[model samples]
Target: MRRSRLTLTLALGLLVVLAGCLGPLQTTPSATDRSTDGTTLSTTGTGSVDAEADLAVVSVAVVATAQSADDARGQVASDVERMRTALREANIPDDAVTTSSFAVYPEYDYSDGERTERGYRAVHSFRIETDPARAGEVVDVAVGNGASEVQGVSFTLSDETRAELRAQAIERAVTAARADADAMAGAAGLSITSIETMSTSGGFAPVERFDVAESAAGGDARTTFEPGPVSVSVTVQVTYRAA
Candidate 1:
């Protein structure tokens, strides 16, 4: 009777284990769903191209502090007008000068973990777009007129040039990816039959910074920079079906 009871317990355990395994087999994916067209070769490639910068964006601002908010705002406004006039006289078009920001806020001094209200501060910033060759001249004109702060200068390609370069960059990336895939397939004794999946992404905004403080301190002297070529880069991820 004891032997018969042990055999029955073992039979039940085996049935339970077999049922668990069969449950997963019922939901197994079909061969088509699990296939990758035999084998796949995956590769990523990057490419970059450089072109001369055609546009220069200069940031300048007028900052003022006074006992009252109204007084600070008036001071900043007056200086901004002066800067605008000087820029216009320097042949920068009115449309090229845009107000980037205008704000009047309270100034505070922190000492010994205590904050003290100082005064009101106002800031007016301008975004000036011009040719790369004349960027220095524009900066000088702004500072000499009324701009108290030279924010920064950046060189970039114009929209037309950027679009052209984007296409070239993508083409080069795809070419590189294909070359890598070919090499990989050949090494594995396989030939790439077709592309099973492909994706790409890339962009670039080349910036060469001109020291704002240095430009500001060089009083009456021309500020200049050799804005070098702007580069555009792109990357591609490709998965090729090989057989």
Candidate 2:
């Protein structure tokens, strides 16, 4: 009887050693884990907000061509001065008128596959910042004063407006994310216990661009532009713990 008891004890010791060598059992979380609120539900939501543009940047250029580079530059400079004077008369602040680019290059004409040097060309571009309501007036003022080219007009929000819109967009995105999480949890017969993790990303939308050259083509007619709303968008990813 003593020998039998010793053999049984040895067998039990061998089983424990084998179990140790195998390590712990591997298991995956399943429905039971979700019931115990150990599972996470993740969802992504997006939001967009549109607001009327309050600021406008009008791009105007003065171009001149002459046989000599000096002559062309002189002409362009004179034209730019005239435009600046006009803008000032129109009540545009001096700080609002800024030079965007100035260049002097040789002009070429390609005809019948022959390239010929036409003349030296000078161009001076100006960016005039103003309110959207005055963009048309500003364009007219520049054109009447010697601006030969109207590049386009960009309508966008001011810094304060952008900040306000961004905040509203983010709030909308968070609300959307919570709604999605709640919907998904409810569909699965679970309730969101808490938000485990969340991340957000957003940005200001593209500015509205308008070309007023066609509208301004009518002689003696005032140029006008109606800008649309600029948008702000945001996206959020949320992970919720559910039971």
Candidate 3:
């Protein structure tokens, strides 16, 4: 009995000594913890590049209504062919004109809470890409042929142009971020030691307005189109360590 008690006392003493050696729990610091360590500054800078749009996309649609679905579809097909011919005459290649949507559905007429089937309506929509200078002419040709509706026109930069602009915008953004950090550090009487983290995001091209009425009324007059400049913006968030 005495040996057992002595053994228990020794075990308790050893556990106390081990606890003291271990001290307290040690945890790995997280990203949030490091960011709020009171020794880092975070700032965001934005930059933009203005570039002329090189391509134009015209949205056009043809619609026809008839007593039968087949009849409506046939009429739509004919109109679509004529529109294609017009586009071809305007020098728009076959590959540049793409059929976006085609549908045929029954029309409904509601009067005095009574529903009646009026007729079948068919619709065919096309997307045409061409030079910005010739966008107005393309629209006129399509409208004069058989296209009943002009859905709006939009302009955009080509892939190569977009890439080039993106690079320039990012470079400007980084420079702006560095300048901002330097200014803040100088005002606070602190010096930037190193860059901790950086992140960037890109902006989209703005839509330019295209007047459908002007194009329709052009007649023999030259249809003028202006694809205004589009701005490509880039924003950068940078975190710097202060000393």
Candidate 4:
């Protein structure tokens, strides 16, 4: 019996030695055992779509200067009233016409070693918005009646119109990006296996890039108003996994 017990103890010792030799098996990679050959690449693509402008905005400033503050203000007040009347007669709503600026300021001239008060300057500016169809008429009245100055004219999207344009623009951008991908693949002698990832942005419609420079030069010819179109554009970036 003692000999049997000695044999069992030796067997147990051998099993313990085997466990120590194996230690713990690693299932995850360590810092030193990392792969350096992996690569992540990026590329960008652009798309553009053009559409005609659908809306217009214009700024008109009427300036009148006189020797006295009351005179300057009174002239501006009279001009404003006539301007409103002209707009109303031209079929523009009072609500559509808004006052943007109304102020009276003093002007001075320093000459002959003395300072002299030139006069008081009063100016009133208005921003007018209306349908594009009859925009020409509105401008005509402003020039013909009391508004002698056209600060600027711009084309833009209304709230509802802008939202619609944004979606259409994105669609066009995506289509363009895919077309570019196909072209690239063809050039590389490879067909598009499949798109792994697609990201896009840009292409907004009816841009307002075209500026309408005011021609106060037409001082005598009724200001010869011209309501021109404007262009607005947006940029988009697209990233796709090159198959």
Q: Mind giving the per-residue lDDT tens digits that candidate 2 earns over 59-108?
A: 99999999989999999999899989988888999999999999999999
Q: How much is the lDDT of residue 28 in candidate 2? A: 84
Per-candidate TM-scores read 0.78, 0.76, 0.79, 0.68
The residue-by-residue lDDT of candidate 3 on 1-243, one tens digit each, is 999999999999999999998998889998878854346888898889998888889999999999999999999999999999878887899999999999999999999999999999999999999988888888888989999998878888887888899999999999999999988998998888899999999876856676434335445554466678989999999999886
Clash number for every model?
A: 0, 0, 0, 6
In model 2, how large is the Cα lDDT of residue 164? 91
lDDT of 4: 0.67
lDDT ranking from best candidate downward: 1, 2, 3, 4
Residues forming the 10-long window of minimal summed lDDT in candidate 2: 208-217
**Local distance difference test scores for all models:** 0.89, 0.89, 0.88, 0.67
What are the per-residue Cα lDDT tens digits for candidate 4 across 1-243? Answer: 999999999999999999998998868888888854322223354434344456666678778889999999899888888988989887788888898988899999999988899999988999898766555556678877788687766656677766676666666666766777677766776655545555554434332233234556674433223334433344445444443
If both were scored by TM-score, which would come out higher, candidate 1 or candidate 2? 1
Q: Output the TM-score of candidate 3.
A: 0.79
